[model samples]
Each structure stands twice: as C-alpha cells, then as structure tokens.
Target: MATQLDLQEQEQLDALKAFWKRYGNLVTWLLIAALAAYAGWNGWNYWQRDQALKASAMYDELDRAAAAGDADKTARIFGDLKDRYPGTAYAEQGGLAAAKVQFEKGQVDAAKASLTWVAANAAEDEYRTVARLRLAAVLAAAKQFDQALAELDAAKAAGFEALVADRRGDVLAAAGREAEARAAYEAAYKAMDDSVDYKRLIEAKLTALGAAPAPAAPAASGAAS
Candidate 1:
C-alpha cells in the first residue's frame, strides 16, 4: 500500500512537470505583461496629478495678473500654461480668463487670438462652445459679420443650441439683417423653457425685433358655487 501511494505521488509530480514545461514561458510572459500594464497605469496617473498641480499654480498666477489688470502679464502666463499643460483644465480656463482681461483692456486682437485658440483646442465641448460664442461677439464688434456668423455656425454643442440661436440673432442684427435676426430670436425664445428667466430676455429681444411672442390666454373663470 505504501509503495502504491508513492507511485501515485510520483505520477502526479511528473504530470505537473510536463504541464509546466509546456506553458511556463506563456505564463511568465502573461504575468510580465500584466505587471507592466499596472506600472504604466500608475505612472500615467502620477503624471496627470503632477500636471494638474503645476497647472493650478500657474492659473492662480494668471488670476492675480488679471485681477491687477495687467493684460500683458495675464496673456504671458496663460501662454506658458497652455504651452506646458494644454491638456489641463487650467489651460482652457486661463485662456478664457485672459481673453476677458485683454478684451476689457481694449486689446481686442489679443483677446480674439486667445479665444480662437480655446475655440479650436479646448478639450471640453462646452468650453469650445463658449469660446466660439465669445469669438463671434468679438468678430461682430469688429464688423466682420461673415466671420462672426461662421463662428456661430461652429458653436454647436449639446444644450447650447438656444444660446447659439440667440447669439446668431445678435450677430444678424448687428449686420443689419433684421428679418433673419428676428427669426433667430424667435427660434431661441421657442427653445427656452417658460420657467427660465433668460426666456424673458429673449422675449424682449424678439419684441425689439417686432416679433414679440403672444401672451398665453387667461384660463376661463369658473362660476362661483
């Protein structure tokens, strides 16, 4: 019985050895691949965190420059942030913030350049839409009506159609296209929810264009019991 048990154990050991001989290299390679992937993931995460920290610091500096009303400094810091960490949210926010300062300081061309970069390169759709909308306003102010309209045409983000329509109306009105402007305003008014206070502003725009929406009819009075 002892001899029989030993023979069985030896057979089991031999079978394990044969399996290892056949699959050892494959198992080793799979383990190495998994470990390499895990390391790569950890490295990527660390890099992203490092980038965000640096970008946050730069954005704070940009904010200080903007607050001091130093458009040139704001633009310079924003440019550095964008160049070094374009993938960070700080870069996009800095672009928008820098453009606002530049525009307020009458640096229209610089503002336009910053907005154009954000419009073309912001990772978030909403940021891109905002950049395009602001760029259109700048273009319209410059009397570049066709380019303003083109920018509006490109501001097509989900949930922003109404705003795009409203801005289009403003651009058309600036361009002396009253009829088209009125139509765009009407579309914007119709798209807005009744509860939205912004709808009233759109309504005022429509009224200014001689296209005020009709007031809802009053509910019929009920007879007293």
Candidate 2:
C-alpha cells in the first residue's frame, strides 16, 4: 500500500510537469502582457496628472495677461499652452480667453484664428459650440456673411439649438436675407423656454422681424352648471 501511494504521487507529479512543459511559455507571456498593460495604464495616468498641473499654471499666466489687456502676451501664452497641452481643458479656456482679448484689441484676424482653433479642437462639445458661436459673430462683424452662417450651422450642441438659431437669424439679417432671418428668429423663439430671460430676447428679435409669436389663446371657459 505504501509503494502504491508513492507511485500514484509520482505519476501526479509527472503529469504536472508535462502540463507545465507544454504551457509554461504561454502562461509566462500572458503574465508579462498583463503586467506591461498595468504599468502602461499607471504611467498614462501619471502623465495626464502632470500635464494638468502644468496646464493649470500656464492658464493662470494666460488669465493674468488677458486681464491686464496684454493681447500679444495673451496670444503668445495661449499658443504655447495649446501646443504643449492641447488636450487639457485649460488650453481650451485659454484659447477662448485669448480670443476675447484679441477681439477687444481689434486683432480681428487673430481672434478668429483662436476661435477657429477652439471650435475645431476643443474636447467638449459645449466649448466647441461656444467657439463657433463667437466665431460666427466675429465673422458677421467682418461682413464675412457666408462664413458666419457656416459657423452657425456647425454650432450644434444639445442645449444650444436656440442660440444657434438666433445667431443664424442675426447672420441672415446682416446679409439682408430678411425672410430667412425672420424664419430663423421664429424657430429660435419657439424653441426657447418661457422661463428663460434670454427667451424674451428671442421674442424681441421675432417682434423686430414683425413675426412676434402669437399670444397663447385663452383657455375655454368651463360650461356653466
């Protein structure tokens, strides 16, 4: 019985060795792959954190330059920020901030370029929408009516449909397309919520276009008992 037990144990050990010989390289490679992936994930997270810290500091500098009304410095800092950390929210905010300063300083072309970059490359849909809206306004002011309308067309964001329509109306009005302008204003007015103060502005636009939304009809009186 002792000899039989030892033989069984040896057979088990030999079977385990055969299995290892057949699958050892595959198991080793799989473990190496998993470890490499985990390390890469950790490295990527660390790099992103480092980038955000640097971008935040750069954005602070950009904000100061913009606040001081130094359009040139603002543009320069924003350009550097964008080049180094274009994926960061700070870069998007810096672009928008720099554009405002540039626009205020009558650097219309520079402003457009900044806005265009944000419109094209911003990570968030809302930022891109805002950039396009501002770009449209700038283009309209420059009498680039077609380009303005095109920008407005591309400014689609979930909650910004009314604003886009309103901007479209403004661009059409600028281009002397009164009919299209009135239609766009009416659409904007209809889409805006009654509780929004900006809706009142849209109403005013419709009124200006002589297409004021009709007053809600009075509810029918209940039949007399």
Counted clashes in each candidate structure: 0, 0
**Candidate 2 residue spans exceeding 4 A from truth:** 1-9, 218-225
Candidate 1 has an lDDT of 0.95
Q: Candidate 1's error at 14, in angstroms?
A: 1.7
- Model 1 lowest lDDT segment of ten: 187-196
* Local lDDT at 192 for model 2: 86
User: What value does the lDDT take at residue 14 in candidate 1?
Assistant: 99
Q: Put down candidate 1 lDDT per residue, 1-225, tens digits, no spaces.
A: 579889999999999999999999999999999999999999999999999999999999999999999999999999999999999899999999999999999999999999999999999999999999999999999999999999998997999988999999999999999999999998998888888899999999989888889998999999999
Q: Cα lDDT for residue 207, model 1?
A: 90
At residue 204, give the lDDT of candidate 1.
Answer: 93
lDDT, candidates in the order shown: 0.95, 0.95
